[model samples]
Target: MENLDGNIDLKIKEISQKLKELRLSRGYTSYETFAFENELNRVQYWRIESGQNITLKTLIKVLEIHQISLGEFFKDL
Candidate 1:
C-alpha cells in the first residue's frame, strides 16, 4: 500500500513534467505567456507544472485551453 502511494506521487510528478513539455512543444516557450494567453493564473499553472499540487478541475481547465480532451492527454500514459 505504501508503494502504491509512492507510485501515485511519482505519476503526479510525471504528469506535471508532461504538462510543461506540452506547453513548450506547442510553442509557448514561457509558462507565463501560456498562462496569460490562456487566461489562467500564472502562479497556479506554474505550481501545477512544478509538481507542487494540482486539482482535477484545474487540470481540466488547462487541457480545455489547449483543446485537448482528457482521453487524448492520458492515451499514451
Candidate 2:
C-alpha cells in the first residue's frame, strides 16, 4: 500500500489481492523477484498488485507469464 492513500476502491482491492494470490500460487515468494525475472518494472508490477493501474496489454502479458488465459482470469470476476 505504499504510495497509495485511502482512496482505493473495493473492487480494485479485490483484484489486487487476487493477483497477489495468483503470483504466490505460481511459486513466486517475492514480487520483486518475479517482476525482475519476468522483465517487468518492479514498481509498475507492484502498482498493479496494489490496484493502481494495469492496461489490457499488461494484463495479457502477466497472464501469459502465469500460463493463464483471459477467460480464466475473468472467470470469477
**Best prediction by TM-score:** 1
Q: Distance (Å) between predicted and true CA of 30, model 1?
A: 0.7
C-alpha RMSD for every candidate: 1.1, 5.2
Q: What are the Cα lDDT values of the candidates?
A: 0.90, 0.85
Can you tell me which runs of candidate 1 are displaced by over 4 Å? none
Residue-wise lDDT of candidate 1 within 1-77, one digit each (tens)?
A: 99998988889998899899899989999999999989999999889998877888998998887789999999877
Maximum-lDDT candidate = 1
For candidate 2, write residues 1-77 as lDDT tens digits. Answer: 84354444666777678889999998999999999999999999999898876788988898899888989877897
lDDT of 1 at 21: 86
Residue 73 miss distance in model 2 (angstroms): 0.9
Model 1 accuracy (lDDT, Cα): 0.90
The TM-scores of all predictions, comma-separated, are: 0.91, 0.81
